[model samples]
Target chain A: MRYERPTTLKAAAQMLAKEKGQAFILAGGTDLLVRLRTGFIEPDLIVDIKSINGSKTIQKTATGFKIGSAVSGAELGEHAALKKAWPGVVEAANLIGSKQVQGRCTMTGNLCNASPAADSVPALVAAAAKVVIVGPKGKRTVAAEEIPVGPGKTSLKKGEIIESIVLPKRPPKSGDAYLRFIPRTEMDIAVVGVGVSLTLDGKGVVTKARVALGAVAPTVRLVPAAAKALIGTKMDKAALDALAAACSAACSPIDDKRGTRDFRIKVAGVLARRAAVIARKRAGGK
Target chain B: MSGITVNAKINGDPVEFICEADETLLDVLRNRLGLTGAKEGCSTGDCGACSVTVDGRLTCSCLVLGAEIEGHNIGTIEGMAHGEELHPLQKKFIEHAALQCGVCTPGFLIAAKSLLDKNPDPTETEIRFGLAGNLCRCTGYDKIVRAVQDTAKEMRKTNSRKGA
Candidate 1:
């Protein structure tokens, strides 16, 4: 295997494009190394992007935040401003793995790994996060949910690299929260995960909302019907019931060792309601 | 094929070695540099038995490539002691009998030290969560928790005395 650390994103993309054999991008290596050790994947070329300029930074852009693809969860947790601006996204990123894993894992890696049960995807989708992709043809931006197509797959074309994920600026009285149901307290994959983000007017009515669910579909789903249930309502029991029903109706999960399809569908609605409650509270609602 | 030469600082000592692109840092530490304190309980990152610090960040050495450590600083369980004097956590672990078969002891010690380094006086829950990555199958973890708590108190007392 050939290992190359490129100091520029263009060079890294070039390396990946020029490689005749299989190539893999080494971000945190929490996932890549595990696959490598288990003989799950044997790539002919490994491109390490940590040396790429601005790949390890969390910058405050005029619109929102630009988190580098190489930034670790620990670094995100330490960024006081980013944490405050998008607590749910930060918390979801921090939930990816154990403290040891958190030291090296990146949100971009988690998203690109494209695990339907990935802890960070639902939250990023609900937050309307966009990734800046750089490839042989140049740069393009896409919604976070557009990246994952299926289990362990991504929409990123060959030689296309995600440089950074941009989060939109949060308006006043806007809050987001992510919740997942796991058999254990930690180190287990999510059976069902939910993320809810909403903005409230002065009268405590939801004006804008987005609801996302994970591990219950081929890709992390952004449920407009569920979000519509919350919009224009005070998140009362009636509106919450509608929200729960919508989330349950959207599930097309499969029966796996972690959970049954019916159980995951049931938990999806439950987690969505609970997440909406927490998000409402964070937005300064009673 | 010729291996890649890597220059790194392991436990405050500058060292250089040649490793394959696919060689994990855990292998390089044990095979090439002869630092076997970090055990390989699971080759995967699930088990923290290979716990070490890369640039002072607690990490599973098995998950990191040796070639990636070219300019990084590494802290291992071997660095936990100062000469003949054992670190307080080590002394407390011995007093509390925190080990059974001794395989996971090195990982636990490194993890506890890292927790204390970040939060000098971690609550029981904090200590439990901080060291959650390191799994000890032989010991039930009560004694290990107590050892870390006792060490924290003793270290805090020493720090206060030095301040005075």
Candidate 2:
């Protein structure tokens, strides 16, 4: 195997594009190294992206924030502006693993790992986040929800790397939160995860909302039905009930030792409702 | 496969080593450099027995590739003490009997030191969450938590005396 640390995205893309055997992009190596150790994958080439300039920065743009693909979860939490603007996203990213893992795990790595139960993806989806994909061809931006197609699968074309994730600036009276259910308190994968983001008008009625669920399908799901339930209401019990029902109806989870299918489906709604409540409070609601 | 030579700083000293492209930092530290302070408990990130600080960020050596540390600074358990005197956390751990098997002690010490560095006065709950990555099966963790608490208190007093 060969290890190449390219200082430019184009060079990295070209190396991956030209590789004949299996190749994996090394960001934090939190997931890749584990896969290598478990005999789960053997790649002929490893492209380390950390050397790329500005790959570890969190830049604030007039539009939103551009989180470099190599930025660790710990760094994200330390970015006060970014964390204050997108608490749900930062919290979700921080919840990926333990404090040690947070020092090495990147949101882009979590998204690209394409695990249906990835803790950060649901929050990114709810935030209506877009990823900057760079490749030999050029650059393009797509919704975060479009990246994961299935368990352990991504829609990124060969050699296309996610350079950064762009999160839109939050409007006034907007808040978001992510919640996940795990058997143990820490160092455990999510059994069911929910992320809720909403904006309220002057009257405190939800003007816009996005609801996302993870660990319930092959890919992280953006449930328009659940969001629709919250858009026109003040998130009262009736609105929250409708939101929960929609979330429950969206689940097609599988039965695993961590959680049964029914349990996950039931917990999905429960978590969604609870998350929306936290988001509402954060938005300065009563 | 040919070896990749990397230049890095470990335990406050510059070191150079050659390792395979796929070799983990844990293997590089233990096998190549003979800095076995970081152990391979799980060879996965789940267990923090291989905990170390890469560029002052607490990380699992098992999860990092050796090639990634070419220009980084690494802090292992071996760096926790002065020439003769033990670090406050180290002394406190012994005074409080924080270990039974001693395998997880290195990881616990590194993690505790990192925690105290970030937050000089962490609460009991904060200490527990900060050290959640390192698992101690022998000690029920009460003793370990107490040791960290005592170290924090002692360190605060010493610093306050200097300030005075």
Candidate 3:
């Protein structure tokens, strides 16, 4: 095995583009290091990306925020402005692992790891997050959801490295929330996860909304039907019921020891309704 | 592969070491530096037996690569004591008997210390959430939780006295 900690994105990309053997990006290493130690993955090279400039800081945009790839969950939670702007995103990122893991796990790593149950992906999908990538070719932007093609897989080409995640600006009276069903109280993968983001008009009626579900598909699923169910109303029981049905209808979860497929299908709707309600409340609702 | 040189500040002291690319921080601290306080329980992040603080952030040392510690600050259970004087969390663990076989004590202490550093007067729920990563199979966690609670109370009282 070999290790290289390049201080520049171009250098890192050039090294990755030239590498012949299997290469892995090391950011936070909450997952990669464990994989390396357990023989789950034996990459010939490890590229430590934290040494790259601007990969570990959060930058404020004219509207939203651009968080670096190596920014740990602890750092995201500490950013009072980011938390205020995107509480659901921050909370979902913090929910990925334990405090120990939180201190080291990165949102970029979580999304790139592409776990079906990754706590960060659903919220990012709902927030309409975009990933900036640098490869041998050059820099480009891609939707966060487009990166995770399947479980433990990514669409990122060889020699491509994700630089950061850009959270788009939110309209006024907009809020988001993420909720996951875990059998354990903490540090467990989600059986079902839901993220809901919505905006309300001055009259307290839902005008725009996005609903996303995780652990129920190969990648996080953005259910437009679920969002439609919540739109054009005060988020009343009938609308919430429609949202739940849409969420349950959209699920394609696998049955395992953690949870049965039928149970996951049922809870998907439940969590979607609950998350939407929380989001509504956060958006200055009654 | 070849060994890589790593430079970092550990427990307020400058340290340098040569480690392989695949070596974990837990392996280096225990096998190389003889800081055997952080044990490899699960060798995964699930079990917090290898808990430490890298750059003042609590982390499972097993989950971090030794080669990545360049220009970082690390704190382990071995540094919880000042010469013969014990840190409050360590002293309180002894006072409360928060251990059975003692394999998980270092992790619990480091995790609790991390919590106390961030929030000196954390609620019981916060304490539980903070230490949830560190699992203790023995003693049912009641004793460990009580030890952390006592340590927090003492630390708060000490801080208030200093302020006064």
Off by over 4 Å in 1: none
Cα lDDT tens digits, model 2, A67-184, are 9999999999999999999999999999999899999999999999999999999999999999999987899999999999999999999989999999999999999999999997
Please write out the lDDT profile of model 1 over residues B13-132, one tens digit for every residue: 999999999999999999999999999999888779999999999999999999999999999999989999999999999999999998999999988998999999999999998888
The 10-residue segment of model 2 chain A with minimum total lDDT is A277-286
lDDT of 1 by residue, A94-121 (tens): 8887899999999999999999999999
Give the least accurate 10-residue stretch of model 3 chain B, judged by summed lDDT.
B1-10
Q: Give one digit per residue, the lDDT tens place, for model 2 in B2-120.
A: 99999999987999999999899999999998889899999879889999999999999999999999999999998889989999999999999998989999999999999999999
Query: Candidate 3 docking category?
Result: high
Candidate 2 Cα outliers beyond 4 Å, as residue runs: none
Q: Score the docking of each candidate (DockQ).
A: 0.85, 0.89, 0.90
Instruction: Please give the CA lDDT of all the candidate structures.
Output: 0.95, 0.95, 0.93
What class would a CAPRI assessor give candidate 2's docking?
A: high
Best candidate (score: DockQ): 3
Position B120, candidate 1: lDDT? 94
